[model samples]
Target: MSHAFDLALCALILGAAVLAVTGRNVFGAIVFYVVYGVLLALAWLILGAVDVALAEAAIGAGVTGVLLIGAWQGLADAGGLEDEAPRPVFLRLAAVAGAGALGGLIALAVISLPGGDGLTLAVVDNQDRLELGNPVNAVLLGFRAYDTLLETLVLTAALAAVWSLTRTRVWGGVPGPGHVTRPDGVMASFGRLLPPAGLLVAVYLVWVGADAPGGAFQAGTVLAAVWILIVLSGLQDEPRLNSLPLRLMIIAGPAVFLGAGLAGAAAGAVMGYPDGHAKSVILVIEYALTLSIAATLALLIAGPARRAP
Candidate 1:
């Protein structure tokens, strides 16, 4: 029965992927893409990767869906979605061939992976030393802290790249399209009710991540969505790039993570915790990271600044 269920899910996922890629309308394609991400998240859950599933559902599907929809709207407003010349048939065929070959190579690599206890055994062996109940969290924030640090830096750099695309006149201006919603509208009312609940959930996710499936990234994504909702409903304005507090919030994650690493260095090893203080330090870093990640991701979806400071 489990094998049959898995087969059914795989079929659904593949079907969604096809619809996303081949849909005629851009809006339909984006919707289908979001559905595909949700299906992929379900696959992760079935594979017993709850953390991965949560991230995929929130960031990959939810946040990315908003970003793409916003981008599509922008392009439509700018008349950039007008019909364009079609690519040559030969070019299209060549592209498909290349993609197929790459996919085949990836499948081959997955099939070739060595069968054994693998990294799971190693993670379990050292999990007790880190004092983190969640091995995934331990690997991300403890064992492989440097890699995670670099990942945060990469997100910051991507935001910078998005900002660089702003027009010269709007450089360092307000981010996003600055949408305004009707005061009595459903969106505004929902926005008012949602943030408080969302904030509570985000905090809980970050706090519980120390021992559970939630984490900074998932919490951050939830917070970002709340901020986006508020801005879209016109309850608040998007912050200018030069806003001091906004800048601090955006950098808080990487800043705190780097600081923690340096603090660890004081104990003779970089990114290491002093004896008996591992959980405390990890919690602090996660909280700070949650704030920064939330800010950075919200701004990323908001796109480059459009209004002057």
Candidate 2:
């Protein structure tokens, strides 16, 4: 039964991917891409990686879908969404051939690989050192803290790149355009109703991350979605990019993380925590990361400044 279910799931995922790649309409492609992400998340769950499933669903499907739709809307507003000339037949054929070759290579690699819990046992044996109940969190926040810190910085850098595209006249202004809707509309009603629940879920995800399959990325994505919804429904406008408090929130995570890493010199490593305080330090970093990640993601989807302050 499980095998049959897996086959069906794989079919659905493949179908979605094909539609997303080949669909002519921009909106249709985005919808199929989101479906692909959700199906991929289910595949991760089937592999027993609940944390990965959550991250994939929240970030890959939810957040990315929003980002793509936002971009679509922007293009429409700017008159850039009109249908364009189709590619040449030769060019189309070359793209399909190249994609097929890459897919074949990946399949060969996966089939040739020998699997035996590559580092699972090693991580389990040393999990006690980090004092984290979640092995994935232990690896991310402890064993490979530097990589995680860099990941946060990458998001910040991406945001900076997006902001750099803003017109000079709109510098220091609000990201994205102003949004307004009827107060009694469905969107506005959802804006009012959903945020409280989203806030609770985001908090719960972060708090339980220490011992369970939840974490900063998932929680932050949810929070960002809530904020995006509020903005879209016209309940609130995006804050100006030049706001000091907003800038501080954006840097809070990386600043706190870097400070903690520097303090780790006392423990003989750059990101090490002092004796008996690993969990405390990790929690602090996670909370700070949650705040920065939420703010960064929300701003990212809001896009570059488009209005004067």
Candidate 3:
């Protein structure tokens, strides 16, 4: 691509991002956010980063749009947080310039960074014996599984805090009422179909991450979005806790991850997942985490998780 083309596209993306962030109209902002993301994804593709483009498009443009709309819809149902007037034009212009300068400096720094050592490559080369293709996922879920494990804990903790604060009296609340307004003109038909399709894609991303540019976390987020949608849509109600299934689902991921880790340690290595069982274990752990996260987030959003009984 021509240099001018790249610069023009980047400008368009930055412009859209600015609008997304500063637009007074929530609906307009979300539309801009999606546009910004697609532009950013295109910029990455133009720069010869196809893998990054894939993720940016999937997570940034697609998932982020859904999430923002969901949150906005929730906010609207809750009467929205309050609105403020737009800034003066001069102030807005100054703000834009300052942001652009900051962005430029960061880009320069990136361009100037020195080449790094092959630390990651070295680990993958030495540990390729596991027959795992994507070292990054293995590293994220295996060697560093502890980090991912704790991340899940943090997610749960945040959810718990929200649930405690909300303290809903029932599954008693009307469906999507008092806090679940769908955006104007955003139909349920497409919304209903999108999650399942997105889910299939998420599974593919997870499976492909074993050999390509995807993984559990990415897949989890997408899958989680589907769950969030289903909950938000009232397809399947959020499971009330203390129930057998709920409790089991909550602990499922962490238990399996730690148990597998312990088994590996008992055999010989710390955090070692069975020599050839790594793939199986990783998928198992990922699935468990997804379920746990979905449940946790739903409960957090709903508050005082109610039993389906």
Candidate 4:
């Protein structure tokens, strides 16, 4: 809150970012990357964008950190973590020069930007139309529902692409490898203990999103993390790629969202909600999306199928 604190936070953020980008150790880079994401989330909180902060903390830091660690594990398992080509001095210099130039340009652009409430007042003025107290929610699910729909579809498409990489022999198989741990081990213990809390938190985030800073993406990320933990800890295994229930959970969100858009078009404008029903519609979409996003994100991180169902 104070200038000193802000300065300290900024320094830490920059330091973490630098370490993430330049660290010689892959694991250390990943740890710093996660720290960088957390610091950025804190910066967002200081700027009063609680929604963005929540998103950054959950998706940006938490889920992404897990994903990176997974990739590292995979690489290590495959012997892909072996020594690589040495960095060329010229390339390093060029990268430094390019990054400096880009940073300078960004600074200049920000300094030149006009000071005004770009769309804040307009969004606020029409906020009541969506019947949502959270302006971010209103803007995302109401004013720009089409964009949100596209985002969900994109995520689904990404998961599809990941699945497409599976070998034909393992097409319908479970993703990633099996995990084995002692029943009383720490991982197994936490896997059993943490999921209940994560589920509660995820549900609360979705429920509070209507009037608060939480939403489908944040909840989905938490749900995905829980699922990942369960799998990694040997409490459960990743679902088969061709499982009917698994597929349904992956498609339910986008399917519902598109259906809502079609229903809106039949009644009137595409993606438009009927009078007095916007919040209900949005909530329905959010809940459906939460499930699909959780499934998709978890699968994406798990990578392609590796074993028979």
Residue range 85-153, candidate 3, lDDT tens digits: 577899989988998899899999877776674356676774565556776665678667789888778
Candidate 4 C-alpha lDDT tens digits along 110-222: 88877797788899999898899999998889889999999999999998888889999989899887899999999999999999999999999998998989999999998
lDDT of each: 0.90, 0.92, 0.70, 0.92
Query: How many pairs in model 4 have backbone atoms within 3 A of each other, for residues 3 or more apart or on separate chains, i.e. clashes?
Result: 0
- Ranked by TM-score, the better of candidates 1 and 2 is 1
Clash counts per candidate, in order, are 0, 0, 1, 0
TM-score to true structure, per model: 0.94, 0.93, 0.70, 0.94
Q: Per-residue error at 160 for model 4, in Å?
A: 1.6
**Between candidates 3 and 4, which one is better according to TM-score?**
4
What lDDT is reached at residue 187 by model 4?
91
Model 3's TM-score against the true structure: 0.70
- Candidate number with greatest TM-score: 1
The per-residue C-alpha lDDT of model 1 at residue 38 equals 98
Q: lDDT value for candidate 3?
A: 0.70
RMSD of each: 1.7, 1.9, 5.3, 1.8
